[model samples]
Target: MIDGAAKSRKAQVHRMRRIFLFTLLSTFAISAQNKEKPTVQATPAPYEWPAEKDKKYQISSTFGESRIDHFHNGIDLPGEGSKVLAPKDGRVLYRINSEFTPGEMPYGGGNTLILDHGDGSNATWSGYMHLKTFADAVIKNAPIAKGEKLGTSGNTGHSGGPHLHFFIYHPGERAMLNPLLFLNDLYYRDTKPPEAKEWGVLLADKFANVNPDKPFRLSADYPVYIFLQDHGVGKERWGVFEYKVRLDEKEVISTKFDRIFFKEGAWSLATGHKFEDIFYRNLYALTPQVRRAKKVSVEAKDLKGNAFSKTFELKIQQN
Candidate 1:
């Protein structure tokens, strides 16, 4: 006795239920596989700390924070005058004698060494700065192993005290990554959040200007990196923060960070591969102007109503 429209509606509802059941099963299967894998990967430790000493040290500073002029680019491993070891077996690519300084911080990857691991991954051009001296004849291109003697830690080149200024670099990215995650095999405790810092908008250009009239396009090749710091009630917080890139108050790009979890306290935006842009010549440019406004703005909001923003004022300078 049902009409044609009712029959169509019933069919549509059945189809939707089928889709919902399929999606639920797929999600459960993926979750089960993930749970079976090691919570930590089984990569070999890069080096051995001398005498089984404590790998525990307070982080003195971080990479990519707003520096006096440039950006700090690596995590500083607190040594407390402890000897620094290689994190993995790598061939010595290059070594720098000078240490890093806040005045010339980014350049102070002091006594640095690059290692080629033959695999797709490479060590973070391990830099042991503030050192008294190398472990004797540890020269460039020398074969080095994990736990092998590199050098004693010291306060050198822009260093505050005796500690190892550790820096890890991915193969081709201009940005450095968090080494603490890669070193999960080590005995360090990580109840703290990854340090959230370097609060600034990724502009459409090198000038830090975004066009409001035009839609701001983030390169999908190289991901836009954001330094996220906690500014809320501690563990009581359990919600996602939303980020949107807009021009002239019109929402262009929007998303929520429900999956980006915090551990040991810090969070980084590197995992969001959806926004990475790499191949374009204008890595970031405020364009596609619709003649509405001349400038554009970017806004970020945490679920708790905490927000940070940056506005790019347009310019017409000729090259």
Candidate 2:
């Protein structure tokens, strides 16, 4: 039988492995005694939204979104057969046009294209997945221009629907960045901040919804979770960029999904914090640190940088 507690335990084990690997790699870099390895100083490259002039694609998903067992490594843009374009000037790494059966898909990324977007040791790669086919102008290893036609978005690979699963990766740094931050010409815009619809805590394997208006009694420490939601101009859902939790005016946890580094073959937020550490249920996650509630608070911000906050009082029971 499937259980949330069991799943959380498994994720906890995975998180421990991530920490161990990060520590091991930090001390064991292979380099000459006096010569330090060259590190890539990469930044967000200016990018046009990778779609045609009139195509209205909605931001269906965001990077580092909690995926039950993993973090979403990319953003999903859903539109009606939008023309996919090169985000910026880059050389083609390769393109694939796959023909698949009911259960078989090529590379699990159907009709995908990867573009090389960095120079020298700065090995950045951009991926356009679930494409129909590459444009005639796009050839393997050839340079492509910004706004140049790449292909049409489609339902390929392990996709459930027709959309573009776009991702940015710095292979040298082993990190996946939030692509929305680089798009200067995206179709959707959000001036609205994320909303704190409700508040609660996961105590002793049970989730208790808190009525902020009413004081609740708690004797022991418990994990807090908040229902934070974000929407675009057209009500399409999205993930936020940053958040913070506090207790009695003291900050307890802070997390941002701007970029996630690959550690020990798993995605981790900051140094630790696996998927379970940051998320519980859906859109309801706070800190793993069991906090004693006095004045519990939350500060949330959306991808467009709009911010919101909420606070509620909880009485601590004296033994």
- Candidate of highest TM-score: 2
User: Which lDDT values do the candidates have, in the order given?
Assistant: 0.42, 0.69
TM-scores vs. true structure, each candidate: 0.44, 0.78
By summed lDDT, the worst window of 10 consecutive residues in model 1 runs over: 277-286
Residue 96 shift from truth in candidate 2, angstroms = 3.4
lDDT of 2 at 56: 59
Q: Encode model 1's per-residue lDDT on 1-319: one tens digit a residue.
A: 1126755554444344324323432342332232222123224234333212555545454443322212233445555446666666777765666633234433333454445443542223344445655776578778887777777776665455666766554332222444443444244332333222332234445423334333454332212333344233333211114455566777655654322111222222343322222101112212333223444565555433566666655332312
lDDT of 1 at 58: 50
Where is model 2 more than 4 Å wrong at Cα? 1-41, 100-107, 137-139, 203-208, 215-222, 288-291, 316-319
Pick by lDDT: which candidate is best? 2
Please report how far candidate 2 places residue 250 from its true position, in Å.
Answer: 1.7
Model 1, residue 153: what's the lDDT? Answer: 71
Q: On residues 1-319, what C-alpha lDDT tens digit does candidate 2 reach at each position?
A: 1257866765554344335433432332222112322433457656788887675567788887665456767899886467998888898876766674354422456787878775654556788887877788777899988778898888876566888988887665666778877777457778888887766777786777776566665545676667777777757566677878787777877888877766655667764667777777555565544345567778888877889887777654523
